[model samples]
Target: MRERAVQRQDRLLSLVRRRGSARVTDLADQLGVSPVTVRRDVEALTGRGLLDRVHGSVSWPRRRDRPGGGRGPDAEDLVLGLLAPSATYYFADVIRGAHEAAAPAGARLVLRICDYRPAEDPARAAGLLAAGAEGLLVAPGWRGPGDQAAYSDWIAELPVPVVLLERSVPPGGPLAGLDRVCSDHTHGVLLALRHLTGQGHAAPLLVARADSPTALAVREGYAAALRALGVRGPRPVIGSVPADRDPEGFERAVQELRSAVSSGAATAALVHNDVDAIRMVQRLAELGVRVPRDLALVAYDDEVAALADTPLTAVAPPKREVGRQAARLLLERLRERAEGAGGGGTDRGMGGGAGVVPAAGAGSVPDADPAAEPAPRRHVTLLPTLRVRASCGAGAGTGGGATG
Candidate 1:
């Protein structure tokens, strides 16, 4: 059953790469299999990062080369596990980067949506881990104490290494030992603030979620930058608006902002993210206010914000680099495990075993071989850069332009 599944997956990948797109019915007919079988194959391959399905059409990832045409690893079932907080565009981009990094190492990437639930079953994630997942990548959802503890315990007990994305565990905590690849939110906010400052804006409002770490970091950075620039006045009227709440709630929040603006509490705003920023823009327009002329705006996460109608100016993080770093760490752990299983040379510096070397000679000889030494594990914290566009005071073709 496993071998047949593998063969079908390989053939499906070949078809997807050759044709650029494949339909389930066409794939089933070409492969001499039932439509149900083809659907399963497509689902499995999609989970494994071999293909992307959109509106009933399946296509190979644009960044990846055709199957059997590259020296990198094939898109195998190497996915150990995944944790998705929400199906937001930011999370999707992060997942895409992870898949790109893992696919080259013959690893599959399985996504599990947490959906802002209070708690998640560790056992639910265990099955994938047991099925040869070398590591786990977690994007935690709306967290409560119980949920946080449950996730921390799961990470502690899991045999494989783990990487946390866009979130942080408690400081001086055991879970902190695990690898982390996250956007530098402090720097991200600094970039946004600096852009606003350069545009001759002062006392710009900062809209944020009250208790979110991402929000807190952004607030801290904004405050610090303001203090450094010798600016002050009512602390920019910070608000705790829940973007994840109901659609009406967001509308209500915007109404409140409009009221505040009418009362002269704020002039310009720096939103926590593009979603909220764009929503705010739309709401202001509906309220008969002009953007940039009446109010300047900036946001975080460039991809989603840039796609907005006004093409938002935002701080962009090294998203793909974060994914690549996390995958590379997990792959190192996997290679260590493979070396241990095969009883190969233990000179890889993982410190898993005592190797076979003459006792006296072992003491006399240097253990570090330039070629045999493991590559240094990298802990990368990437700062965000400002992508100035038409959304802010800078018009299109201004000195500051969209970042790659």
Candidate 2:
């Protein structure tokens, strides 16, 4: 029965390729089966990457030239584009999430690193789309008004959906309608602050890249915690480090912190993200500063920080979950398109062809809508609990020296 069903689906697809569209009733009559059977066949075939059903109609899948000069079916072949600035452990995890999502759906994932040049993104996006990418996952290197405009334009022109990971865009931007998934930095920061304060430390320094939304949120969370404790003298000294120029940039940050410590400005320091946090700890150690005694430290993104010598007390986000969600959403969109083509009575069995329209669904897929505004005074902040490791004093409950 399964073999016969497969044969029937193949025949229907062949007809769709030739006729450009196939009606469900026509397909049922020709196959000598009920329309219900045809529909089920079409759905199964669609899931298998053989056909696309659109708005009560079916059409043959489009064919595109393969890179090696042979023609290939477009329905089963898809390009999933990924954009990032530089290769880091953090970005790598995000990419892994996206790939895990795309693999089961029979889509190919392509990666292009922008190297911090936001200007180059649009051209890269266009080239990928031209190569037949069905969707995109972008991790913008930096944020600015002009960069936002370019990203918006690129998204508007793409033939499929674009999912932004770990970055926020401007309000009323072109990509505003699209989906986004980001770490709940505000809540993560609060958790870090509470951990430090609970350790009986006050006047900790908050270090980050200046003016970034994530940095700002961390600073705000720290300030709120400080205020709640009624500790007032001078504000927690917030400093910015550059993500583009590392080593030297980090060295400069170390010097600044040394100066702060000398002047009695800050005792403990909270590094913005894990990357910087790890670097900060290393640099401080090189300068003969002991962690948790001379300067207690906490960082964000526990995954990356765990790789450090101290195994940092950092915030962990639902990273793999984010990737799985995005992948599921894109697959849903593809499936919807398939169903629409099948029901239309057009060519249900063939790949891409004329008379097939893409289908859009409400943001029902997991993490499909990243920009859905949070409720008033309430944010969907993923909590980052203290990992209680050797890096912070919580490990052995000792207020002095590093733990083993």
Candidate 3:
């Protein structure tokens, strides 16, 4: 119900802005709502001074007298685009977070998902820029190895501020020139490894997608945590999931887990994400291996781990928080660029797209500053929480989970 109200309000705002002024009856008819509902919404916006309410008609505040007054930037004039690699599973939550953030942060949001294909993002970003998007929030570098240079380089060259969500340049990617927000995946993996060790599983295998930037960090964290736990000898098997999510590769990933288990390569294992973890769990069941009895499992990015039959213990990333932070960061950058208030730095690293639409009132802002000190770039790392449940056998005597 709250979501419905918010959507209605957004629609109302868009309509008023488009038409300059609208009658309450027309608004109600257009919005498929009652005149009373339109009046109430108009009343709310009028209180905020966003709408000039006269009798049954509504209109946006005039220039020099809008919400931000004469000089302040207005959010209504700006459009920020978001490009995500995946539309489902893990990335879906990030998009949800960004969507929830749009109204509060004050920018109009344009969202596009490329189905995990990084090759297509440049074109999408180009299109959004041409369509008048002023800034961008993107999840890039998730394709295969050869994509880093092209993907990161393209991001480096954009004409507007870019905030990366769930991604930052790893090695061979573009060097730092943008803001980043992502989970502290290394620490997340370390936590899972420590929990596995606590459960008496010393030689747990770590299964991960080798091509993933987040997975790479997790693998590093797993090793670092192992060192912390005083296990310095040969490390556990670091099994790699292939780059493709294609049917053949998907089957191969399941087969890889089965081989690892059957060959005794893993007494206990930490899988990188819930999707593969669920697949591994289901396969283990078919192989007659009951979870925690014969094998202990810990999954990362706990999006759907709990939905599995055994309800696996998994490390849950602060996914929504990452997106929220990224949105906030992007908005701040846009504001700074518009106001020329902060020391400015033009985007570096190579390609150019479209210019930002000029600002007015609160939405009025400048291009990049030429003389001021550059604003500090931000990188927020949020930690993941482990949700303990049945798969890790959480109970006194059966204690293999960290419920405390």
Question: What TM-score, computed on C-alpha atoms, does each candidate reach?
Answer: 0.67, 0.63, 0.70
Candidate lDDT (C-alpha), each: 0.64, 0.60, 0.69
Query: Which pairs of residues clash in candidate 1, taking residues 3 or more apart in a chain or in different chains?
Result: 78-108, 79-108, 80-133
Candidate numbers, best TM-score first, in rank order: 3, 1, 2
Model 1 scores what on Cα lDDT?
0.64
Could you tell which candidate, 1 or 3, scores higher by TM-score? Answer: 3
User: Once model 1 is optimally superposed onto the true structure by TM-score, how far is the C-alpha of residue 112 displaced, in angstroms?
Assistant: 2.3
For lDDT, candidate 2 versus 3, the one ahead is 3
Q: Which stretches of candidate 1 lie over 4 Å from their true place?
A: 1-77, 142-150, 210-213, 240-244, 247-252, 263-265, 340-378, 395-398, 402-404
Runs of candidate 3 exceeding 4 Å displacement: 1-73, 170-174, 232-265, 343-371, 395-404
Give per-residue CA lDDT, model 3, range 111-148, as digits (tens). 76677677777777765564346678888736665566
Per-residue CA lDDT of model 2 for 21-112, tens digit only, reads 78888988987888998999888766754557897676655543334533221345665767776556566676788888787766767676
Best by lDDT: 3
Q: Worst 10-residue stretch by lDDT in candidate 2?
A: 373-382
Error of 3 at 94 (Å): 0.9
